[model samples]
Target chain A: MNDRIYMDNCVTSAMAPEVLEAMKPYFGEEFWYPGSFVSTGEASSAAFEGFREVIADALNAAPQEITFTSGGTIANNIALKGLALAHSGEGRHIICSTVDYPDLLTHAAYFEKMGFEVTYLEPDELGFVSAQKLKDAIRDDTILFMSTMVNHVVGTIQPIGEYSQVLAAANHKIWFHVDAGQAFGKLHLDVKALGMDTLSVSAHKIHGPQGIGALYVKKGSRLGAYIHGIKRFEGVQPGGLSLAAMAGFAKAVEIVYKDLDGSIKQLRELSDYLLEQLESQIEYVELNGPRGEGRACHNINVSLDFIEGEAITIMLDMHKITVATGSACASQGLKPSYVLLAMGKNQVQAHGSMKFTLSRYNTKEQIDFTVAKLKEIAAILRERSPLYNAIKKKQEK
Target chain B: MQYSEKVLQHFMHPQNVGEMENPDATATEGSPACGDQVTMYLKVDKENLIIEDVSFLSYGCASNIATASIITEMAKGKSLEEAKKITWRDAMEALDGLPPVKAHCSVLAADTLQTAISNYEIAHGLKEVPDFSKETIIGELKKIIYPQVGEDIITLKMVKYVGFEEKTGEVLIDLNLMSFDQYRDNVAEEIREHLQKYPEVKDIKINFPS
Candidate 1:
């Protein structure tokens, strides 16, 4: 019966009101198959292509190079698998960081099965891969360099611009892919400035409708096709994307950039307040990701000793507060976050990891309320942990 | 997120959510690889060979807690020998079957129960558990988790018997279990697929008589 408080923005955001309003006409009166020659359909097609131009302009890429897909997962799949296949003859070896999103990892796994070699380079203890190490990782036959704009679990925003420059200097025109699903709307992304051959973005992460996302493919990039269908989005994405959803996604991006500074300031202040409260109000807790600007502006991850992440998540849910956990039990893979593990956390530490991602809509009041609930839950769960009890007993001596 | 009704009932109102003091035996099963763990305690009547009571603490997902809770429900009054026959499949069936992805939660519960039983066996100096196979049981179990494709049961420490006749091509398993006297055959079906592939394992028998 408590008020619902959502801290799972990294998972998905509620659609922005402006986005909803823009998409309304498309759902009913403006419903038409894009690219059709008929009047209504032609109008729909123009609008669809118009947003495509807007997104391309945002990324500083040619409109012809922008392709729409189902969402972040599909965008990533196309980028990784498509580029790997397209460049296999150039070399079978690929350089990738361990903190890459699981979707990219899964695709790397598939590539490995196909006889392409992938080197899973680990980042430093702070979830960072140095440019020098990345450059050194480039083998003579290394065909691609893939990482993410941000670490999904801990919100460590990878320095994409620096790493892309390293790759460019190491191997000219090497396929550099960045899965920017979490970072796209929160951070400024320019394909030219970052020197990235491809980048992936999802609409829902920016308060747009689900099932709509875009990939910025550099104009000269030789990316192959993954899905076999009509060349709907410039011969890359097969099958048509949801026209209404695409319009909604474009408006979402517009509103995000139009109010970019204000939103960023609000989210930064909100997350900063949360971290301060969590640190000052709780005991036996440690933040997982980097502390300040090195991290994403919208998220925070912390590990609480003597308690499982799922236990805390469930307990918090009972109080009408929502967050996310990557503990073995919390994940569908039944694995602790490889991202956290690669960053040097032990099993227990990884199992206790909890993440809270904020949105522009979040308020200072919600952070205070959630922190109070977390303190209460931590005390109760610590009381149940035998390890905590044993440690207390030993301390008594 | 769409858990079964049974999972919701057990997770929302979990039973035996604490530890016991001075237990006859205790065991913990968890791996850094999975990031989930369950530590179980047992109070056993050594002379009568019954599991008097059981309790557990888990750092895992909803299924992990639910599965552990249900196993304690199933094993509370059972004999230790009977409790040893409790399989993860029993817990799966009791919860009306876990989501396939969460099947491992029941496997964790079952494995931890076996580890607790083994701990009991060690503390009381009961005779070492009978060999599950002619070959070193641990080595053969390393080849697989169950008779099926999941986790390897050897590392899980739940293998009870593996009988193979080279000449007659007959394979039999005592089949480690954590619950459900009636769910033995379902587990058997999984084992049959695993062992039946071999030219030597012409016939397979999983003896779980309820």
Candidate 2:
């Protein structure tokens, strides 16, 4: 097949066929606006309820607890800043990892600007954070602990479940939020089981329409104290909804959940085959994030030293393969990714990090072809690079 | 992302990359931490005010790396005065286009060219070249330590070398602790602070482990 081998799924995924089909009715037949209409309109409130049920089921939460937002960014903003603002009276301390998405950090900064103390914890070289370290950082003034389930750049899955236990031991009152845009559908997440108060997910990352996402708030949670919108999401998320996009998101989540085990296995196999192909062809390739079972199956952050990542990306594009250097949101930046830096990577390695994420549609042949093309381009670039040759010769001894 | 044909052309096949034999002036910039490095070599015809040759070695992102290579092509054969005036705007235009953020990299290209020209003048002794080498750096420290140990570079092996960057004229050194802990430990910092007192010394080379 001539399908373009896209490995930047962590940025945004292509809409699933099933998601498109489910959304078709909303764009055409049942196109009524959900806000002002009466009972007999072309679209009914039931449409939104249906979407809510699907998302709640996928999240293992009560349907009433799910609140829709524009995307992961907005969901994270509301969850983090809102919780901080609401609970500042109880405790002014907020803890976040230095490697978190800047959007979430920006929200934390808003809390800082509002007179709350914020601590940005740094991760280890493997991009893993210890629960003990987080507990040590926490104090009596700590009101919330926020982190990522999957780091957007390195794709290192954090021990959020373990951190949850640490938080519970300290005080059940501390709110925990996870930005799982890169991990939601790919990895298993059960909000209550993980002892999370707020969870952010994006439709685009899960093969649904773009610019649509949802946040999960546990039932009877006091998130209402932090929320400020025209209409209260039981006092937390206070915005109207995108019914059509939410419907598509709902369908996408349904499809993903229905085939979760099979899709996970397929993704694991595809990632394995691709990683093997890369390893066999490219010498001196350093895989970032975790070394084996500790990593997320969908993310493989590889650094081919001496060759710049932007160059590798362009050459791969020439081969009709799409991948990302660091997070898609941060790609426009010139500085090396802060996420990789927090993991103790020097500047060159951080700037050279590339994320390869696989979706359900990637085939084995495509992976092989991509590997062959990457090897050829890397070899050509290395031959022309004096830096690479110098480093190679020095290490040869 | 479709780059202009000019960008692709320059990126795919840049001209004047690598070294020149016995260059009159050389400049290296960028950091391995930042995932990019560039070294530029210049041969200036002093009598004619012409740049006889210019070459570069870059380890960086595709566009900047390519931009560095293309810069030499644009600069070659131009007068020293003309090459110094080459702005990042001109190079970006020559490449057809570069991302706005990478525009800073273009400035790095311009700065390297200027620094190379300046280094040429200094290396040729057309201007006063400052000496911040380990010998001179240690000489300054000996003046401070001579009062205590009465020993200098010729006498003792107290100095331990750490690291050095040749292009930027920067160096780091360490003075390993002997059996005694209080045997003049602030020599490194004292030397570093003293070196800043001299303007001609563009950078300080240090020795650590004391």
Best by lDDT: 1
Local lDDT at A102 for model 1: 78
Q: What tens-digit string does per-residue lDDT give for candidate 1 at A204-316?
A: 99899999888888887887877787865352377766788888989998988887778777788898999999999998889997999888889899988877888789878
Q: Compute the lDDT of residue A16 as modeled in candidate 2.
A: 86
Candidate 1 versus the native: TM-score? 0.79
Q: Per-residue alpha-carbon lDDT of model 2 for A1-397, expressed as tens digits?
A: 2567888888888898888888888778687655455663424566777788888888888888888888888888777767776777889888988888777788777778888888888899988888888989989989988898888877788998999898989954888998889888887878878888899999999799998988988776665344456762231245655567888998889888998878788888888787887888888788888865677778788877777778778878877899887521125433467788778776667666677888888889888888888888788777656687677778897
Query: Candidate 1 overall Cα lDDT vs. reference?
Result: 0.78
lDDT of 2 by residue, B1-210 (tens): 446677767667778876678988898765554455677888888798689888887766666666787778888999877887776567778887665435444555665787788787777776676555656665444433321332332235666663445566565656654534433433443456545644445666544433
Output the TM-score of candidate 2: 0.80
Candidate 1 residue runs with Cα over 4 Å from true position: A1-3, A33-38, A225-228, A232-236, B1-56, B67-97, B107-210
Residue A288's lDDT within candidate 2 is 85
Best by DockQ, which number?
2
Scanning candidate 2 chain A in windows of ten residues, the lowest lDDT window is A326-335
What docking grade does candidate 2 earn? acceptable
